[model samples]
Structure formats: structure tokens, C-alpha cells
Target chain A: MEPIKNDILDYLKDNSFMDTNIGLEDNDSLTQNGIMDSIGLLELMDYICEKYAIEVPEDMLTPENFDSLQGITNLIVKLVK
Target chain B: MSRIVCKKCVLDSDMPGIDINEESGLCHFCETYVPFSAQEKSDYLEKMEELFREYGGRGNYDVVFALSGGKDSSYTLHKLKNEYPFLKVLAVQFDNGFISDNAVENAKKMCELTGSDYFKLTMENEVLYETFRKAAESRDAFPRLAKYRASDICNTCISIIKQKLIEEAIVQDAPFIMFAFTPGQSPNPIIPLKANFIRWSRSIFEKQLQKIGVEDKDEKFLIKNEVIESMGKEGPRMLHPLCLWDYNEGQILESLVEIGWNPPDLNDSNSTNCTLNSFACQNHLEKYGIHPYAFDIAGIVRSGDMSREEGLEKLHQALSQPLIEEAAKKLNCR
Candidate 1:
């Protein structure tokens, strides 16, 4: 996994009720798999913004940017650059 | 099986996912807990004032307040109006078919005192009853932590409230929507209602309602797709002022009572609005071996907002069996 993806996964594990038994794939939809709910997503967004010191643009708040590890990693990389 | 309660909070070993360290006598949540610092609290209060100033008098109604007619919500409305009289608020109280008559009256009374419009949001009685019943019967429909935050029935109700209020905010062109969530009920004080997030949440909740066997073809429990499309990049923001404010349950009740808010005569100690709450709690306890309010109350205790003894007293307060049986009978799920 990319370092950013690893960090995101670590944060989820630490804070969320993600079932480690079922494990997770990079592309698996977090909301669909019950890894994160709406409130959890808000919390994750806050974490990303604070950790990366990047204010996410409103238009970038798509599932393609947040619903999966790969998507989140890509979004962070795009923002960091 | 032996039961061990947390020394710091009201959580105990009987609750799922609650692990008490025998040596420490503290649950994992309490052990790893961090309270908001004085600086952080001040910052939050400043941010809230900024939000109020920016969104206060922009339109016919600047806010869609989710008033549950509970002590927290009533007090929140009273305080908000007192502090920001410029705000045009439409207080919405959801009538979930099981809400006490007194709750409706209290909601109306608070709105009258606050000089805000009061709107009672009601759905078909049969549909609401079926939804609550399905929520009670459905298992693992929500994630474990979400379940810990509230009973399945309450989670269902709150989701509906969120979706409906978001819709109300968008449709009414309000810049803000407010919910009187206790500090323990949610972590964030402000959540921007981005279009993507709203769409995402709508889809997830639709799936949840479907899982509970509710045919939401009418988008009964969701934001309409057109509303999502119309919102584009962003919509109204959500604020939980209770999370930022100094929270004291005793003071809140006293403040509300001074403003003519009457507490409903209910056996449930945790809630002040819905009569179905006791039934929901009893059902949750029976189903999951957990008192649904344990996590929320525990957070309050951990924050030192409430004494551990008070938290335990609230947690161990006997649920109203008569109310539970009545609700169950009404839902035909007994």
C-alpha cells in the first residue's frame, strides 16, 4: 500500500469499528462495507484535513475521492502536490 | 459471568465492545480518552459565533433547527434565540407517532417563547410504526460503534431526522441546520453539508432502510435525488452547538423549565421527548446485552460533565415495561 493509504487505514483501525476479521481491500467501498458511516466519514474528513493541513475543496468531496483507500490516497496525493 | 463497571464512566463489561481492565477498573474508552482543553473549547465557541454572524440574517429563515422538545433541544433553542435574536429559525419537531403530547406542546411552547416558527414534521403513522418495529427486529443493520451510540430504533429515527432536516434546509434555502446533540452524542461541533456527503449518506441510509424491509420508493426516509443534484458542490452546514457549549444537565433542565418547557411524564431517564425511547432501550438491552445510552452517558461522565454516580443512576434506572409493551403491541411485534 502507498504510505498515505497505510496511514488512512491505520487511522480507521484506530478510531472506527471496522471489522478487522473481514479485512479490507484497497478498492472496497468503506460506507458499503459498514467500515464508516456518515458521522464517521465527517470525522475522517476532519482528520485528513488536519493531518495533511489541506482544506479540501468542496468539489472534491466525492465518493471517488473518499469512499475507498485508493481513492482517499489519490485525493491526498493530489492535494499534497 | 461477572460484571465490571468502569471506575471513571458508566460503561460496564456487559456492554459489547466494552473491555474493563481488572487492575485499572477503567474501560478501554476511558483509558484512551482525551477531553477538550480550555483553549479548544474557547476556539469552538469562537467558531460558533462566527458561524452565527455569517449565517444569521441571510434569508427568510436562516436555520432549520431540529427541536426534539427535549431538555437539551429546548434549552438550545432558548439560548440561541436569546443570544442571536437576528436569526430566523424554523424549529421542526418530528412526530414519530410515539412522541408524547407533552413533547409536542413543549416544542411549540419553546418556539413561541423563542419567537421562531414551529413546524411539526409528521409521517404516516403506519409507516413510522413499521420502521421502528423493523429497526427493533433488524440486527447489525448499522455498524457496531453506531449501535453503541444509540439503540437501533434511535439510530433509525435520527437518520430520518438528519435526512429530512437536510432536505428542509436545502429546500428552504437556509444556510444552517442545527441539532441539539449532547456533547456525548457526536464528536464534531460543525459538519459542512457538502453535496457529495449528503448524496453518500442518503444512499447508505436508503440501503439501511431497505435492509430493515422498508420500501422507501417514495424516498420517504431519504433526500430526494433531485435535491441532491440541485445542491451541486455544497448546501447548508450543520451545527451541534451543544457540543461546543458548556454542558450541564441540571442547568439545562432548570433553564428550560424557567422558559415554560415541561418535561414529559415518562419512565425513561435518558430521553425527554419520545415515549418510544424506553421501549427502544429495553429492546436494545434485550437484543444486544447493552443499554443503548451507556456509551453516550459514559462520554458525559468521562468529560466530567456528569458525575459517574449520576451516570450510573441514569443507566440503571429501570425502563418502563408498560411503555415497552404498549409500543410493541402498537407495532404488532410483541
Candidate 2:
């Protein structure tokens, strides 16, 4: 796994109710699969801010960027870049 | 009557007034799985933080928080105090006459630990019981079906507390009012509090009050004149920080524990506070054929904080509480 994927996994593990089988290639329907809810999404935004030192714009918390591990990883990459 | 099942899920037409597509059998609520775009959520959070900071961070003491001492409210109080230390949190508790000792303790502990000023309001049990009995007798006691399943008496208590909070805020020159409502409960974007909105809400209740033989003049006390007078002076904006942060039960528990907060074990079976909750759920289920907590618990389960089996168990326990039996008699459900 890449370093960023590891970070995502670690963050999920620290939070609650994330799948134990989460991986880079795992299914990304977090909301559909019950891995997270609306509030959970907000918490993830906070985590990203504290972890990557990225100021997540409020507009970035939609389903497009947070649907899966890959999506979140993409978001982090963009912010870090 | 023909049954209407969601083509996407098992939700049936008999569920409520929900309509399903004839071709797909999917209802609008079910069809819209993904609610927000990632960008919208991020922008909303950032905007919320900026608003809080611009309103004075901890410097401006312009609002009162309605702290129920539940998980959501506790979490909200924690964030409000942490982010805006100077904000005066007026923790108000409406003793419905049967609040659990643990709930009372939690309310007291939250105030003591935070050093926020606190107040308790209790209504006469007989009067509350009489009002609730009358409201339950009337089918339309509470016209807003989306927000609450509480008895008419419970509704009366909530109205009284809400009015009191607004009055106290205005008298104290506070500019905002806050509650712990989640997105599914109250989804309006965070904005400046308006007194006209308060008046409109009061009018809604005034109609209901008249139906139950409550005089219009009596409703005036339910909403104070001073609060109405100060509406244009920039009343407090109602904030829900819990909506701003991503929250899961585990994360909330851990964070609260770290801050010296504790959850009541009884909440595991029924509720954290409000002895009447189990009864309330029972009343809703008996009348509506579904638990009022169904939507909230389903949301949580769908979000992965709890298992479906666990949700069912909680539902069953809530239905089986002795309070339900007592409430049944009181509401003439039997």
C-alpha cells in the first residue's frame, strides 16, 4: 500500500464502524454499505485537516470526493499538491 | 389497497405517504442515495467555522445553548464551549416529572465540568399530564409529523422551554440560540436567527393550542413579549456544531470520555435521559406501526455505527419497557 493509503486506513481504524477489509481496491460505496453517514463525513473532513495540514474547503465534503478510499486518497493528493 | 414497494429497497407504499415509481418501484427518498457532493460538504464545514469565528469565537457572549445532556447535545455543548469559550451556555432542563437519576446527573455533571451557567425548569406533573392527555386525544395535536413523536404534554414542555430560552437570551442581550439537532432533524443551513421565524412557529402552535382549548392569550405567555420586541436587535443564531463535524458514536464516546464525560448504561437499553422516551417510542409504534426512532437508528445503522441486528434489539427493548404500558393507559391506547 502507498503511504497515503496507509494514512487513510489508519484514520478509518481510529474512527468507528469502518470495514475491517478496507483496502485501496475495496468497494467504495461507504454510504451505501453503511460504513459512514452524514456526520461521519464531517468528522472525516476534520481528520483530513488535522492529519495532512490541509484546509479542506467546505465545498469538498460531497459524495464525489468521499465515496471510497480511492476518492479520499485523490482528495488528499490534490490538497497536498 | 395495493402495496407499493420501492424497486430499490424493501420499503413498501403502506409505509407512509411515500410514492414509488411504477416502473422501478423506487421511491424518491430511496432513489436519492447520495445527498451531497464532496465539495459541497467541505465548503459547508469551512463556511460554518468561518461564521463561528466571525461571530466572535469565544469573545462574544451572545447566545444560550439548550443542553439536554444526551450524546448529541453533550457533544454540541463541548464543541461550542471549546470553540467559543466566552459563549455563555445556559443549560436548561425541563423535568417532565420522571427524568432518570442518571440523566439528571449527566446534566449536572456537564454544567459543573464546563463551568457554564445552568438552570432547571419543572412543570407541575398533574397539569402536564392533563395537557398531554388532551393532545393525544386530538389526532392533530402536533401537526409537524417530521420533528417529534412526543405526547402533547411533551410538546407543551418543549414549547415552554424554547420560549424561555429565547426570552432569557434576549434579556441577557445574547445574540444567538443553539440546539443539538442533527442534519436529518433540522437541515436548514446555519444562518442568523430571526425573530419573525419565532413568531411564525408560535402561530403554528397557537392554532394547535386553540384546538385543545388553550386560549390565545394563554399562548402569549408561552412566548414572551420581550423576546418578540428584541427580534430586530440581532437575536442569536441557532448553531448545531455536531452537524459541522463528522461524528460516529464511537468517536463521540471517546472524545467525551477524554473530556471526563460518561454515558449512562441504561441508555444502552432505552435512552440516556428522558424517562418518557421509551413510552414515547411505544406510543408512536402503536399508533404509526413503526418506532419513531426507526429513521434515526436506521440512519445510524446505514452509516455503519451500529448493526441492523443491534438496532432491532434496541427497538424491541424500547417497545417492551414498562413505561410503554403505563403510557398506554394514560393515552387510552389500550
Q: In candidate 2 chain B, what residue range of length 10 has the lowest lDDT sum?
A: B143-152
List of clashing residue pairs for candidate 1: none
Interface RMSDs of the predictions, in order, are: 1.6, 14.2
Highest TM-score scorer: 1
The list of candidate 1 runs beyond 4 A from truth reads: B22-24
A54: Cα error in model 1, Å: 2.1
- Which sections of candidate 2 miss by over 4 Å? A1-81, B1-13, B19-26, B57-60, B147-157, B189-191, B216-221, B257-262, B265-270, B299-318, B326-334
Among these predictions, the greatest lDDT belongs to: 1
The digit string of per-residue lDDT tens for model 1 on A12-41 reads 876775555567889999887777888888
Across B15-43, the per-residue lDDT of candidate 2 in tens digits comes to 54355778766755455554445576678
List the lowest-lDDT window of 10 residues for candidate 1 chain B: B51-60
